[model samples]
Target chain A: MLKVTNDQVAGHKAGDGKLGPLIDDLGRFYKPLQSNERGSNELTFYTSFSTNTRIPGPIRRFFPNFYGTQLVEASDGSSLQPHLVLQDFNFGRVNPSIIDIKIGSRTWDPQASEEYIQKGLKKDRETSSLPLGFRLSGFQIYQNRELGFWKPERTFQSLSADEVDLLLRKFVSSNTSANLDLQPDCSFASIVYGGSTGILSQLLELKAWFEDQTIYHFYACSVLMTYEKEFVSNGKIPCAEIKLIDFAHVYEGQGVIDHNFLGGLCSLIKFISEILITPEECTTEASPKDIQKNQIYFEELIK
Target chain B: MLKVTNDQVAGHKAGDGKLGPLIDDLGRFYKPLQSNERGSNELTFYTSFSTNTRIPGPIRRFFPNFYGTQLVEASDGSSLQPHLVLQDFNFGRVNPSIIDIKIGSRTWDPQASEEYIQKGLKKDRETSSLPLGFRLSGFQIYQNRELGFWKPERTFQSLSADEVDLLLRKFVSSNTSANLDLQPDCSFASIVYGGSTGILSQLLELKAWFEDQTIYHFYACSVLMTYEKEFVSNGKIPCAEIKLIDFAHVYEGQGVIDHNFLGGLCSLIKFISEILITPEECTTEASPKDIQKNQIYFEELIK
Candidate 1:
């Protein structure tokens, strides 16, 4: 019942729509975050703000968010390079002095593009020429590389206050003493089931209430899903990973860079929002006696 | 061990010979956050950065934060009004016509301080007041007879994704399935609880990795705290109630103004840091049991 941009829930309108530099109902419920991948092949970004949150005159667009680009070759093959994924990107406002949001790699990296995808697949080179579903929101994850991908990768200004008080007392005493699921001890990446951990030894899942160890905050909604093999297809699993492949209706939050990087921000959503939002809005409401004791594991992950 | 900033954590120098602004080592882990009694004793906020994260105005005076000037009592009881808290507020670069973060409100709400706290607290007057807090992260949540906490509060951009999915499905499934031991859902407030029933509703008491429905995301660290009446420490909670707090950890992320807001910019951490990086670094590896469980939860959050 809530795909609604306004049954007045907030689609609120009053006329000439009081336009002082606009935004009375800008795009109202956001017109599918508009995108043509803005001006050619894609990879655009521009936004800056933060004189301490006094936002106005603002009007933002950008949102398709991420998909393919990073074509570097450079071994003996020179430096193939291409990493594209741009469009609509024209940001501004949110500036601790235009501070670090960088993201203009112009492309290349898969361990230096695995020798540029093995010399463009041994010269068969189509390098997929470019352009399939470009989309992209604002992907700016850097790495000249040494080894990364387990999780817990700090450096958001190397953070400190004792690593934000050891990431909020190991995220509220990691469920009564060490049950941490995985992702943090970051030099970055390692997983054979929660590997090489150490930031707060991973267990946050996705917290959003007054956010972080709370006092007054309650605008909630969260996401962080990361799993890949390109996410699935030939044997299935894609369509936004079979519409949120029901990982037991996810919930784990306390913080350590939000339990190891919002699971890559839930693997770049767009499994067509898998029916926008449901598994009972990402589940979590047990009991009919634990929903009749987990009712066949919640009908086998909503089948 | 990282309270470092006089420079050197990776090589060790901060012998604290104090070249200034090591900020008493994150001020022995932050104590005074205060702001209750009628609020705004002019609260301060600091978070400087550089070493490419840019802040360089001679190391921005080593990050001095929060500048406030306080004294209030003017509901026309003749004067004592002054209040400021601006501090080193820079927003010069990262241009797009230029604005670099702004906020100069004489009134977004608080209509003339709700006609002076409702006709000046029935004429006892010394009232340069502000019971308005609940600015929904600067957007909506109001009620006035001269502000006396009612509870319709809206902000987080005046909620409406179906009142944030009917208040996260009535606080994560009907008052979190009528709380038994899981306690949490009264709207929550008393500083840093992690919203949506704070501390991320302890993942609705887990219920064994959220039985099947699957959608995982948890890793947060958003502390803003403001609530004091500890039975009457004589503190009146005001710094303008940061506009009437209620965060549920601000999450709506897909973009609709901070793109569904929730601590912005996360492209699945740029697709796993653009997938297992390595030119010479960002390779990441470790799983000795998640780096000995993040050094025993960073040694139990700085003990």
Candidate 2:
């Protein structure tokens, strides 16, 4: 009953020597039998599907961040096209202060790979090692219908050291208290991030998810950042939106405690802090010298 | 330590034979100790809390239906106020076409109580019988901030038999297909219900939830019907919005399949059909006779 194309089969094989395709078993690589599309199955699927298609209200409206994959019974017995019924996160309309960016493999720092692998092994005993890299592609930003909201290459290219540091600071403060746990004052955090209350809540949720590495098993996940530009007013940093997408290889367990997400998150935070965090100061604590280091780190990440 | 007042203790004990409160174990009943509020914990929580309060975007903007309860740790060891961070369902601004009405214990037919009790026992083995008359009072519509959106007594008193039939038909048609399941035509349904795509989605979701007896165990859940006036075009019948709320007693389990919701839904549907469905045709098949039956069923339910 399930029909898959030759190119899709090839792409799946190309992912790993014996590793399966990124998608879950419920999902299959679908190609339009009638149309002569040249791109990858995901690319073609995304391209052909119209956003105006009537997605169930719960999925389209409530669960905005994740890609909700639904199974439709094809009455005609003809093969159905595999396309994402994506919720529109109109950052330009919703919150103009935030700049959304999709970070993929290009953003994965090789220097921190060893650390990530070590952490992943310690957390997940069944699979004692992480994959070579998070196989998410930055170029796949075109998957979302909203144009210009996420231009990873352009945004990263244009970013100065100070901008990245400011962005990182805002993200960190929102999720964590002065201590690791315990958000002492909810009012203060809400006040600090005046207009972008929605963005802050989103990031905090994503942070919570990332912390719970036991249940979530994301393979080559893409992290989307909706960074606040004017986060600081008179030097009080707020929060930004950081969410994971493309859960093709994501799995949930009843009580699986691990450091899969945390390891990756730590590696990322470390890499970003290396550039932004001064040798004398902690990542949480900001300093005058952080500006100069930000420039240095920005240049490194850009390269 | 968790501190509680004398009245709060009384309310908790009164819910069951020493079964501490109507709230889940994860939830504890709390009263604003200083306030002179003389309502149930839920009503007091809803009334005292500000809708404009900066609810985390996830709970506020996204996932509007479910009551997301969070534990706030008091740093000073001072008691934190237990209040609902409710998202406002502004029918006036959002969907002017719809009139929202909350149906509570008053809607439960005393005549049908015996049948419902037998049905409930056959479904859930653990809870062998239905709770003595779904103890939710329709008068408790004031539990929500925006008053009069759910004045069921007033709404029913004003509505004629024809109006009641029209509302029920719209709700049933939207949820169930002509043959039951398989809504072949999406566009037709969307066209019939204009503007409030979000409301339509919410009703569909509630319908699905009710259909699923395995997990959802809503004993005395309140039904909030957002009935549209122009449900039909040029006398053509269409669907409207109907959603369930007040998930105070709702529970989920792997194998706890129950007929609590189904019994209520079917009874209402059958009653509506008796009034609307003529001997000559199916309820799905529209006819002028439906108008006649609508009046009859309206009186039956009201009585």
* Per-model TM against the reference: 0.19, 0.24
Error of 1 at B284 (Å): 27
Estimate, for each residue in A1-303, the C-alpha lDDT of model 2 and write its tens digit.
Answer: 433211121122212222222232343432222222222433333332224243333222223333534443222343343333344332232222232232221121212245563453233222211211121222211111233222233223233223433443433342322122222112222333224444434433443443332333334445554433233432544344444444333333222222234333333333333323232233323464754565464355334
Among incorrect, acceptable, medium and high, the docking class of model 1 is incorrect
What is the C-alpha local distance difference test score of each model? 0.21, 0.32
iRMS per model, in Å, is 16.7, 23.9
- Cα lDDT tens digits for candidate 2, B1-303: 333212221122223222221222233432222232222434433332225343333222222232434343222334344333333332222221233332221222212245563453233212211111122122211111232222233223233223433443434343322222222122223333334443434443443343332433444455443433233432544334444444333444222222334333332333333333232223433455755554454445334
Which lDDT tens digits does candidate 1 get at residues A61-114?
112233334343322233343433222111211110001111110122112235
